[model samples]
Target: MELKTIEELNQIGFEKIGEWKINKRGALDYEITTDKTTEVLYSFVKVDNQKEEIIYIGKTIRTIINRLNGYKKPGNSQFTNIRINKEILNLLKSDLNVNIYLFKCNDVITYKSHNINLAAGLEDTLIKYFKPKYNLHGNQRIIDDVELSENLIKLTNDMNDDKNCQNHYLIEKTTTVSNLEGKINLGNVPFSFLPEYGEIINIYLGDIVLQANFINGNNNGGNNPRINCVAIGNWLRENGINVNDNFYIKICNNNSFYFSINKIY
Candidate 1:
């Protein structure tokens, strides 16, 4: 399938049904009143002045209102809804602008002897072609990169085998709210990955270094050790490192570590 831009989708049949934004009470609200029962292929787009980019694309047989409500107050079992909700909230918190667009497909076509719902069929095509970041399919490539963590573990072991080696590495996936807030759980990392608790360490994000205190989670009843570096969180957000992206840390010594990001494409 070929990639289609929002403009191309608009030319094909998509419509600007309305916009969506967090309301005063922190709930998602669409600007124009819409039919609660209309099934649709909807998209979330980020707008910056005249520039627009599609971030997510989805189709639902469920009522449009019901679909949006799924994002507003996602159920525990609704993983997609939950992820999208967190992403949208994060974007809004950063003071970025987002809008929603919709398309209703009425045309039915037969494949072989079976009729296909155009919206349903088009959903996969759009996702595969456009690759909206918030959609699961859009993140498949980055998710596959998690294999890099396994390889990195092996490398760290190789380095640790050397009696004189003090350097180690940790490859972690950014999957928690704490990660975005400048705290990283070191529970899964080896004890040697960081210095002794209460010691100060320099965290390097490129050339920028932030000295931070270390708290060994083990000493605190097995609580995960953390690096509370607000600057790293701000850097991640500013650099568009959303949740689920993989990042690596190079522990150069007992007193310092550096970061490298594998951003989502």
Candidate 2:
């Protein structure tokens, strides 16, 4: 059914179909389906550690119940559904909540969605507007991303060429010491994208800023510079990233490096 409001002025007999939650705790292993003959549905899922966040927003031609139930089954031919649901199941296995929500739509409602092409078009619009994580497939609102790129000049040091370059060196004898906050390790960490050593690396962490030097290489050319864990840990700590967690040291420009935090294991 197309979305419609019960407009008094238009004399349309529109009633909003409602979604009720199903407790999946007991029958998680079983196939699930819907009670209603729903034509359109919106699913809202909250992955673990994100109780406040609806990590994914989705719409389906099937009823909300049947669609969410499809995740538990194997041999799904839709590659995107299979791929994204794997992530969802992982989150669920880790004791994270995958709360499925839906918006109800029915055929007998005596009103029409004004000027909208209806179901599929509305779904696309909702996906773009919400920017949900799991809707990686389908049409995207590239305008927002393009505008962001326009605002920030492209940082050009692509790591592929840097990785294969002869100038890349892995310096040794580096150590990580533990502080009250956490620990740093003794390892040869490479900031492969940096072109020069002993140069200032400015890391902006919210209101706090951390600065470190890219120590020059001791090789014959003495060209490859690196910033170790001691510097990295401190910078991450200031920015709320743990030292033990996997993170990347990205050199965006000469004066700045972006430290991206990844998962612990």
Candidate 3:
């Protein structure tokens, strides 16, 4: 027999039609009068406004349907009726407004045998090919990649022991001059040290270093200690420096200061 039209079948509410055939395995094999069973497998709802989207694809199987709805308490069944039930429920709740298409079969093979096996094989192939979002097994490769990136970031962060040290110092002051002159700039410092200083100081000092000029401020003078404590504090926090570490800021000139981060790691 020829396969029934999709529109016609949907109008009849898939359950009332009883014309089907049973194969040797007691599985239902609907005889398609017009198209082959493979064609019916190709028909599926395109999801997410995709021109080539194929959400769900499967051949009509009487045994599969009977097994799904046969028992009021299907929880004890060997087959994965629970998963199948969820899949159907998800489809009904989907925002894409997808419709299910039923193909009437004229043959019924023995249950759990060749016909059922063929239907299952076809289902697996379709699941792999289209990768429906609702299907849990579908799109596994992409999901694995996403999961891997998250794991890597978590692992790297976990390796850092002193990640929350707030009062860390970045620049160590080791030298002092009675009469110091010229520009001081911290921008020439290594990129690794840039994180030690808060983002603002890093930007300012980095710019100064790049220009080869030091920021000569009133904080360091001939009589007073020539250390930019504010800049050092910013650097410490940025680099995860701890307050317990003793360090000093070395003034390179009026425009820049050398930041030394105390190692607590």
Among these predictions, the greatest lDDT belongs to 1
Count of backbone collisions within predicted model 3: 58
lDDT pick, better of 2 and 3: 2
Q: What is the lDDT of residue 256 in candidate 1?
A: 58
User: What is the C-alpha lDDT profile of model 3 across 1-265, one tens digit per residue?
Assistant: 2223444434533322221233466432333223323212323343455433444444322233332232112222112234444444454345343343444444444453433333333444445655765544345532111111111111222211233322233454222221122112344343222221111121122212211211222211111112233333454555554444444443321222333444222
TM-score of 1: 0.49
Ranking by lDDT: 1, 2, 3
Q: After aligning candidate 2 to the native by TM-score, how far in Å is the CA of 90 from where it should be?
A: 1.2
Q: Please report, as a residue range, the 10-residue window in candidate 1 with the lowest summed lDDT.
A: 144-153
Off by over 4 Å in 3: 1-53, 58-79, 90-96, 103-121, 136-265
Best by TM-score: 1
Look at candidate 2 and give me any clashing residue pairs: 176-184, 176-185, 198-214
**Cα error of candidate 3 at position 93, Å:** 4.2
TM-score of each: 0.49, 0.36, 0.24
Model 2: per-residue Cα lDDT over 137-161, one tens digit each: 3246521111111122233443323
Q: Each prediction's Cα lDDT score?
A: 0.61, 0.39, 0.32
Cα deviation of 149 in candidate 3 (Å)?
25
